[model samples]
Target: MLSRRLALAVATGAVAALALGTAAQAAPARHGGHGATLRTLAERPDLLIGTAVDASALAADAPYRAGVSSEFSSVTAENAMKWEVVEPARGSYDWSQADRLVEFAHRHHQEVRGHTLVWHNQLPAWLTSGVADGSIDAAGLRAVLRKHITDEVRHFKGEIYQWDVVNEVFDEDGTYRDSLWLRELGPSYISDAFRWAHEADPKAKLFLNDYNVEGVNAKSTAYYELAKKLRAQGVPVQGLGIQGHLDIQYGFPGDVGDNLARFDALGMQTAFTEIDVRMTLPADEAKLARQAQDYRRLLDACVAVRGCTSFTVWGFSDKYSWVPDTFSGQGAANITDENFVRKPAYTALADGLRAAARRAGRH
Candidate 1:
């Protein structure tokens, strides 16, 4: 059986499959464009087209590296920057993999998004065990948390453009998820995490990121209230990251524009952080077409909102997606297929960006 963490990692894939099946339909053609790279199309509007990348893939996968460099203007380390990989042992740290990714992004002139200073999943065993064993007290945990955030942020202070200070802190129903942080450090941990990250690197934009909050729903409402409260208290919270992990079956987020607008109204920048539209196995033309439509809708939502500056796919190609393993019988959730072939969704993204560019009078 898959561990709950792995299951949650791909939970969005399952959610996509369930939510979109009945709504899957042919998407109408809105625009036509050819051979436009995401970077070029986004340049005119000052929008950043980015992707989450596995660090090993950056060094080992030639074609994947080329694809990323040629297309995206920003990159986020999918797992390398997470707590498990960065600080597996108490008071010990490793920066090899994360450093490699930051170096690669700088070499390619791509900005970096530091993923997650605080998350419940993917935590180092020692930290969780300490909590579980009662060896680490609440005050000790708070000190440890501060050390982790400060050290990580300080190490990459100028290199990373943004930091996801807190990730997936809320449950789907708008309540705080019962994580170790909340249990030990309480609700103040969230605000403390953001403040610590900011103090470490005052220039890096700090954000709270979550999935299933892309539309104007209960989950998003939670974020809106939190953003408003954080700002009122003068927390260094700057942005909201909506991980747009779409599945063809769930249909597109209809109220995405309104949801983004609400966040923007609170003086916060918003971003489509991790986007991918997946479908069940044995993908057909209609499924692919619907995926294309979903992709377009997400990009359109970001473009329609001011201060919605960045749009990043979870990963660019289906070859390395975490979907299939996490969601049985479901795969191909990315814009490109396994062989680096441009799928319909790829063209749809280009078309959307091109249209946005033209509308902004960049063409």
Candidate 2:
């Protein structure tokens, strides 16, 4: 089972080492001038500024650990908490990588964001195969899912502050995603997920996280409707997580503030869950400068909104960015370069928070 686990992880990540040269282990631990970290610059103490952590990087890479501990107030297990990594086999679950991330966060006084409980991607081969081949029936699959949520949540009950319970469950057209869960259990699976997660850890704030819903689009509107319906039915849904994966080429999502406000009006908490403004490859200073402005705009919107809580970057450094591997010729998606040097975008983010602090009568 562990062999199966190792094989799956290797299959997905074998290209990272080649794509990204040797680790930035030599990068100095300290960042920014005068020790004005994001944690300290954040005038709103409740606002958590964070980045996702790759477990292998966190383990073998010193600079990586330094970046996470020195900068962020929160950390999300990038892939460690996903089903494939945690439960590689049906009955075999490995919490070592995820547990290390949690323990590391604890030692550094950082809260953890439990990445996902329900997602179509990164599912165990066994689970997916069983479902595809009819070995796992609807009722049986539901029970299996319940066990996962219950065991995983209970395992890390007090450690995690927010759980991206159901991720990317909606399509871009405001329709339910054609996921394994949707295929088996239908749309009710969404609410069922929230209920099961709540039953496991009553205190952990639950969020429905998705990308392409950063603005008031059809996708986001669909989420708003679903959240409203779930609330009406007394489901314990607490947050709407907008994954702000922006591309500088597309300009900024100007309506982000209004979208957050609508969810806020629903007595729901909203977060810019994953904020990264990427650009086309061979990035010039001009493109980087535009990236800075785009980053500032998103942060400013969150700082202005009452219900906007955590602002998390997908990853903090270009060296470990997932952009290039996933998107051809798009790599500069983080606040820092390969050497861990802070970029213009990094300055813009800090300045945005400071600007928010200076603004009077923010209601």
Candidate 3:
């Protein structure tokens, strides 16, 4: 949501437990050589490999649709389920486009991770304006927010595997981001949001998602402390989402494994939720090679952590990447080019998954 992430723009587009043989048995990649699809390699490690999907592109582009359907076993709606798209007019809700996505997931035999139930960005105008003008008093704001979470969660209750109950709530400095909810409701908003979401879908794992928390730094420490507090209060806060939006220019976040280890110690689900490594300007073989290592590094961290159950790329192709638009002079963040060709980073992920499968097999 911040500079570290303009996470999922539009365009683009795991696991199991079983024998290594079982992974080998899963479908081979359409274009991948001797190696099976990333989804297949994930089976033995019992991890979910996924991507943020652009619903419009899925509907109109055949190659994009095929790529999503075959390459990943889980899907998150890039913007389909966001507040502005689903509840554009406050009380008026439209689930047409979002429902199509859920259906597509079902048809592809993919699990769905709800993009978010609470976020400061992409909010509908009516809600923000109401809050701005004091038309939505604190109590009224609370009620409205509760209703939004309840309705959305209840509608897709049993189908969704997880819900990003609160997203990008904290800034890089470890302070709660100033927003309508924070200003009116104070810090209690995070716990309240989780409670409301849990009440609506008890089966779904509720997660606190944010960027820049890929390591055990200030931002991640804030999440760790808050998650510990929430769970102690019986808040049903069940997961931590690390948005792995890395940049090759900054080098990889070396402590990602250590960060995920701490969360694993918390005994809650953790995931590399939205990962994409970007470089500055034109891509060279060296930059691309380093990008591959970055992708491999993040995926390796997740595979090594017991509680980390999923790894997802923000989007799969550069054709529809949000990077160029959001960050000037930085592009080539995805694993594929515009024509759906795989890159070194794509192979790196496949290799990581295979290694995980081998490890799982050894055990």
TM-score of 3: 0.91
Clashing pairs in 2: none
Candidate 2 on 1-363: residue-level lDDT in tens? Answer: 012222333354444223222222234534555556675567454688899998889998788777787677789998999999999988898999999998887655567889999999999999999988999999999999999999999999877888999999889999999988998999888899999999999988999999988789999999999999999999999999988899988857759889999999999988888888888989899999999998888898888888888999999999899999999989899999987888999999888876777784332
Ranking by lDDT: 2, 1, 3
Best-performing candidate as measured by lDDT: 2
Give the Å shift of residue 324 in candidate 3: 0.6
Error of 2 at 64 (Å): 1.4
Per-model tally of clashing residue pairs: 5, 0, 4
Error of 3 at 100 (Å): 0.8
Poorest 10 consecutive residues by lDDT, candidate 1: 22-31
Candidate 1, residue 24: the lDDT equals 20
Q: What is the Å distance of residue 275 in model 3 from its true position?
A: 0.6
TM-score, cand. 2: 0.90
Q: How close is candidate 1 to the true structure, as a TM-score?
A: 0.90
